[model samples]
Target: MQDFREAYQSTAVEVQENDIQDNEVELASPWQRIGAVLINSLITMVLYVPLFVGTAMMGDSNGESGVMWIGISAVLLLAWGIYQAILMSKTGQSLGKKLLGIKVVTLEGDNPGFVGTVLLREIVYNIILTVLGMIPFLGVLISIGAAIALLVMIFLDGNNRRTLQDMLAKTLVVKA
Candidate 1:
């Protein structure tokens, strides 16, 4: 009986050690996450510069130049989206994340593929937020509150600093 108990205890310890190693990931700090977000936002805003310039050059009239500019803007936006999706899917790092030395990964420490990164994290999450924002009277307020809640969740999650998008996509941001 004593020998059996010893064997069981050793096996349990080995299992525990393996579990700990599996979950050993250095989570990104809140500041790093915030920096990444700001960097990404800046990149997005920079991408709109051409659109703004084209609009200004074309004036208020919907002439041929205006239409062309609109087309250009659409193409630029689409290209940016594709770039982000590709990077996120391949390496779990967007331009901002790469700059910040952070990456998005599954809870198991694997890169989240396109379905998780683009579909669930980006498209579905944005759709939900957009739907909430489009509600009748309280739409704007609800949307703002939800955004705040998501941000707060990142800070409040003691074990894993996951936002709502991360939770929905079953992903985590960790140091690259």
Candidate 2:
């Protein structure tokens, strides 16, 4: 043991230092992401409130009126999706994330492009969700399972702090 310790002590070692800068990034906490998502969801709901009310008021028990209401809702949803995509693509921060001083970036700590932020992070997952939601009871179960799995990943990802969407886009949410 003494000989081993002597040998180990005699060995020289080097430690590499990181280049610290003013723009050093910090990993976002799970709570921060959750809060941001909730706040953003509220904002989205607020934007859709008027349309929802109008559609509700105009909707009739008749199947004919139902189709129109569905069409209107679809248009509004599409518009909102586009708006969110544009904001995320340009700033790497949604309104909630901006307000919270958190932003999304690539794994290497650079801005994720429109394709990464919008297409991979948002649209792809939503498309899956929408498709699954169209199915019957099994779909609901699967959707719930997927959501739970995402939450688990977010919580278990340690210092990396990535969610499923982040994993998919090779992105990270970090303090700005």
Candidate 3:
């Protein structure tokens, strides 16, 4: 009877472990994720440059243009943030994600919504990075370290190819 009990317990433990492993959905391909990032970066740059230059060039010597630039930049950023937060939260797909046929979803494969995934999970990191970027040499060093760490984590993760941001967000990127 003791041997029978031990065998049952071992089987049960194995089953539980397998179930947990199975719950992790298949991840999107690395190339897809990279493509999404590139597309998003291009979009951001397109939106940023024209507004920044236009505002800067429009201001006179009194610094009105500078103030205008700041204000306009703030507004543009807010709008872009809202757009991303809403789309990602509601659909689990940003423009790039949609284009690449990938999605961001919760552990249970549900949309995490704007407040949970976008604002808290994603935007919070962006805001932190922006603040950090405003600093001098230290900021640049930190950014470099962050980029290296992100790549390392994604490549080296045995369970999933999750970057630091994905881990922090409690989200998964999966093929659609």
Put down candidate 3 lDDT per residue, 1-176, tens digits, no spaces.
99999999899856654553587666888888889878988888776764677566665574666666667767887787788777888898888988999987765666767765677667787788778877888898878887887767656547467676776776667887
Tell me the tens digit of each residue's lDDT in model 2 across 83-158: 7778899989887888888889876667887988888899897898779877887888878888887777767745
lDDT of 1 at 74: 77
For residues 1-176, write the lDDT of model 1, one tens digit per residue.
99999999899856643453488878888888889889888888877876776777676665667667767877888898899899998999888989999998876677889988889998999999999889899899988898788778778746477788987887888899
On a 0 to 100 scale, what is the lDDT of residue 154 in model 1?
71
Better of 1 and 2 by lDDT: 1
TM-scores for candidates 1 onward, in order: 0.81, 0.71, 0.71
The worst-scoring run of ten residues by lDDT in candidate 3 lies at: 13-22
Model 1 whole-model lDDT (C-alpha atoms): 0.82
Q: After aligning candidate 3 to the native by TM-score, how far in Å is the CA of 6 from where it should be? A: 24
lDDT of each: 0.82, 0.74, 0.74
Clashing pairs in 3: 59-65
Q: Cα RMSD for candidate 1?
A: 6.6
